[model samples]
Target: MNSDAAISCPPDVLDGSRALRLACETLDIEADALRAMSQRLDGAFSAVVQRILQLSGRVVVMGMGKSGHVGRKVAATLASTGTPAFFVHPAEASHGDLGMVTAGDLVLALSNSGETDELTGVLPAIKRQGIPLVAMTGGLQSTLAKHADWVLDTRVEREACPLNLAPTASTTAQLAMGDALAVALLDARGFGAEDFARSHPGGALGRRLLTHVRDVMRSGKDLPRVQPEASCVDLMREMSAKGLGCSAIVDAAGTLQGIFTDGDLRRCVEAGVDLRARSAADVMHPRPRTIAADMLAVAAARLMEEYGITSVLVVDAQQHLQGVVHIRDLMRAKVI
Candidate 1:
């Protein structure tokens, strides 16, 4: 007989079995804790946000072990969302990193027991600097809470671990609460795309937030342009030189009157038009979709998507051709 057939399901996999029993235990404990957290929300959470907002200096987040990991993320979220903040290891603060926290700064400390020795070790120095302490802890009576300027009680019934040792649900709750606080502050500060762009000017979100059509649009040597009076043969030369497969046909005053693309050229050839003698204005599509130079690349994307066009002319309010933005360029940059 095969071992796979011979072996039965583990005791944990059956009804009212080990896994079922433990899952019940975990759910009961965590569910109650989560529910309690909802009821526990009061003035303290507000006070923390208020204090951080009022502070003239940065917010220093500190913790140890798993809490330390959560603290780093909390600090990052806060910093990127308009509030200036950074994480500091509690142990390092006991050494020399304490210098990072200034008298005007606000400190948000994380510890499940509310009595992390490393954190408590630097409390005296923080007190000396007169820095405000906002403690996140499960134990209200813990030393850290007692010494805190504001205490957020995150009391939990038990750990999700079978041995009731490892932090699972507690840390999840802490991270969730931290995110809530950061987003709330972000909203309150009137934080918009531009404010977010400054914090994250290197990624796709940054590009979406900061990049404008003029910044990425093809111009000067790369611009596909021809005079309206130019022959189709001459317009093709401009297209070939720029490799844009299209050229803007501008009037004597430099106002965009039409666009001549490869598609238009193909149609003209199919119609047996005399390409050598026909001027650009006679052959080009009139009134092509145009975008303003100051418009966001994202807005350009919206206009392109709505019009189902591959290219848009970047022009000023006065309709002077500033440059051209192509769908291929936006795609290559992953701006769409």
Candidate 2:
């Protein structure tokens, strides 16, 4: 046969209806697996959570092949949700990485067959070290399950793959079980958004909850402020010098009397008022939108959006002008 003829074949004809039907079938299979797993959860799941809570060390997850991929994601989910955990490839564990596991640490081994050679090879060592093992596998009577202190049955009736040879539904069941464990542990530990934020300082939730107005606000010399009796020229100069687009009108005692922004200046100009003759207090908007310095930066962003303004003054309990936060500051900090 000619090499080109042997390698070439007609493109498979597209069948939109069949494709959609297969996709729906796959989802239905996986959804059914999850529902069955949820129904099968018993005291064993809760015992695992309770044991992990009392553990002083972290959860070390191990697996091979497709199970390894799922294990990595499960480890990440657990770590981010306030459970301390990490993934260790089972093959690597046999190659001296088992030293990473300590007495207090718990092992969460994943293998669809529960007899993966690389994973099972380390069981004896883990047992000798007296480290508790929790097997997440479809194999109930396999070596991994036999050696485990607790067995989480992640078995599925069938794969979502058309040939029923792939790890689709089984891996989904394992991942869902991992998430269930993390959520249960999170609730038992009373882990809240703040705790989750600390673990994900680079994420959106962290930026919103951990970042405060004081952390992003302009203070001291950077804050634009003019005394109540200062001329409008002085106020404009202060605003321009600080580049905050607004100036706070403060009294002699550093109390925030009012705020003057570019809008206020535009109104003054449109009214044909002599800015040079006016004091900061005369052109300022009193009782301006203010936020406490301790408030979350996202809250400051919300105030700016709600009032259709670009800047807000940060004040203390006694209404003393502490700082100024511009919309740009919130954007730069990614709080918006």
Candidate 3:
């Protein structure tokens, strides 16, 4: 069996309060570091954003070690949010990847100490290429900062690590600063949800934005439907054949009259009403919840959840029965 397949209880379940306290303390340290760093944002932050926005090419993010990991995430955030960016390992840049950077591109380097050898090693090439450089570092006087066109200070009061040697608070501060810059640029570019959805076509958000109700609905013969004058037996056959647990009852003009669900059948059975004797209109729910076929599938999902329903009728502009949409269909399409 896969190790991740098994769900394990916390080994220290009895130490819940102790664990909670420690976790909260760690979060507090990182949060406080971000707060202090936010207060320190000034002209340099503005200058950095201005430089990035003016660039027609990608933002080449470079870092070493822990800062490198944070740089990758920052680059991804920038790319997905409209400011094109990608991360290059400082070591790799010193080799051959340095060619990836163009003069039109802007370089954003991250080094908490601002003296990381791997990063400083590639400074000359970046400068020789005349690529505008922006630095994120705690040390303003360090070489990486001195050689850059702009710098964003990410200084933290202390590390959350007990030894103060690990980069807990400092890394958190750097990540927060990166996020701040990305968000600022996002606002500047006027990047909307549709633009983001296009960039992330395979994710859940993409599905929500791109999928429409008509695309996933069962139409024509596949739709579970019955005439308002049809008997309960006919409704049951229609519902069972379609496997939707419900049937839409429409009038002679093909306009929706009501819906008869499994729950309605159960109620009728308890009341001792014979299924063969009654018409679908006599036992159906009038004015049933419905959605337009052109509406977003995710919006239909929200309507179902709000009404505590498992399915809804899809109708045209004039409330004519067009199709049937089930929660299962939305789930299978990954829109739910």
lDDT winner among the candidates? 2
Off by over 4 Å in 1: 1-32, 272-277
What does candidate 3's lDDT look like per residue over 122-194, in tens digits?
9998998899999999999999999999989998878888778899999998888889998999999998998
Better of 1 and 3 by TM-score: 1
Candidate 2 structure quality by residue, lDDT tens digits, 1-336:
888987696457878898899999999999999999888888999999999999999999999999999999999999998888999998999998999999899999999899999999999999999999999999999999999999999999999999999999999999999999999999999999999999999999999999999999999999899898998778888989998788998899999999999898888889999988889888899989999999999999999899999998999999999999999999999988
Per-model TM values vs. the true structure: 0.88, 0.93, 0.83
Please say which candidate is ahead in lDDT: 1 or 3: 3
Q: Of the pair 2 and 3, which is ahead by TM-score? A: 2
lDDT of 1 by residue, 1-336 (tens): 778866754554456686688888787778777787879889988988888788899989999999999999999999999999999999988889998888788999999998889998999889888889998888789989988999887777778888879987688667877887898899889999888888889878988878888777998878888888898889988999988789998887878899999988889889998888789889999979998988889888998899877889988888988899998878776787
Question: At residue 226, what lDDT does model 1 achieve?
Answer: 86
Q: How many residue pairs clash in each candidate?
A: 0, 0, 0
In model 3, which runs have C-alpha deviations exceeding 4 angstroms? 1-29, 161-163, 192-197, 270-277
For candidate 3, the C-alpha RMSD (Å) to the true structure equals 6.7
**Model 1: lDDT of residue 281:** 85
TM-score, model 3 to reference:
0.83
C-alpha lDDT of all candidate models, in order:
0.87, 0.93, 0.91
